[model samples]
Target: MSDQVQRDQTLDISQSFIVQAPAGSGKTELLTQRYLKLLSVSDEPENIMAMTFTNKAVDEMTQRVLSALKSSFKPKPKEPHKQITYELASQVMQRSDEKEWQLLQNPKRLKISTIDGLYSLINNRYPLPSQLVPRQIMAENWARDNAYRYATEQVLLMIDDKQQGRAIADLLLH
Candidate 1:
């Protein structure tokens, strides 16, 4: 890609763009740079949201941003990509210091999360009538157990039907 494209993606934060690329195309790096730039310009760290599809991606992105910020305190790295990250992180550190964001000390202020997490955050802030009760993400084991319970309930209900009950009995015997 041309430098202009790179600049547009990372430096031009005025407009949002959907980045679609193959694997290992430095999308995360570009996103981390853009996030740092956004942090420098944003009034509050929470105002800038970076969402990904999965929790793992969210964790990775958050770690990358935080790592970049921590790395800015060290000597400049030799790699070109690391140099870009260092420069952006340095700019963010300066802006953070001026604004008293305390990003390095309180990295949780950065709002990098999964899409589901964003929905949950929004729901927590402005819950719908149907969602009067707060919801929590179900753990894998809980989900599996709940699914089994639901399936058992459905099968028990089916047992009340004569034809289904006969089929179930035959299947069990077979």
Candidate 2:
């Protein structure tokens, strides 16, 4: 596998880059390294925008960036690359442009997010077709509540407990 991403490859400065990483992989490390690299060459400090899919990722990335920045931005130092791994995930995530940062500082931009949140953003950005039925309504909380109530009602309606147990098992498996 390639140890480093090749920068000479094609890039579109105006567009966002999406990197898909498998679970448990070193995605945070790679992202922070790329962010640091982006900062290294940029004349405009606020030009580069990196985002994580969830709040947890944002926290992780922010700490990694700050640690890397602190070490690199300083004068002669001790173990120089201690900040590389983000072992100490202790840093405040702030925007280079204060106004923009302030605008998006909620739990939304703070990083930890549900899949539904991401899908909503995608839908808003690239809307579905004109006549196509609108995307299935996301029962953010209703699905759980409704299914529980319906199942309980069905159990109460059944005469024999043994038959109800089999039906419940079948419903769950299917």
Best by TM-score: 1
Q: What is the C-alpha local distance difference test score of candidate 1?
A: 0.85
Model 1, runs deviating above 4 Å: 1-4, 129-174
lDDT of each: 0.85, 0.49
Off by over 4 Å in 2: 1-17, 73-174
10 residues in a row with least lDDT, candidate 1: 132-141
Question: How far out, in Å, is residue 77 in model 1?
Answer: 1.8
> Relative to the unseen true structure, what is the C-alpha lDDT of residue 108 in candidate 1, on a scale of 0 to 100?
88
- Worst lDDT run of 10 residues, candidate 2, spans 85-94
lDDT of 2 by residue, 13-59 (tens): 34445666687665666566556555444544455566546767766
TM-score of model 2 (CA atoms): 0.36
TM-score of 1: 0.69
* Candidate 1 local lDDT, 1-174, one digit each (tens): 895566556568888787777898888988998998888888888999999999999989999999999999999999987888899899989989999999978988999998899998887876678865445433555788999999988887797688799887676688
How many clashing pairs does model 2 include? Answer: 4
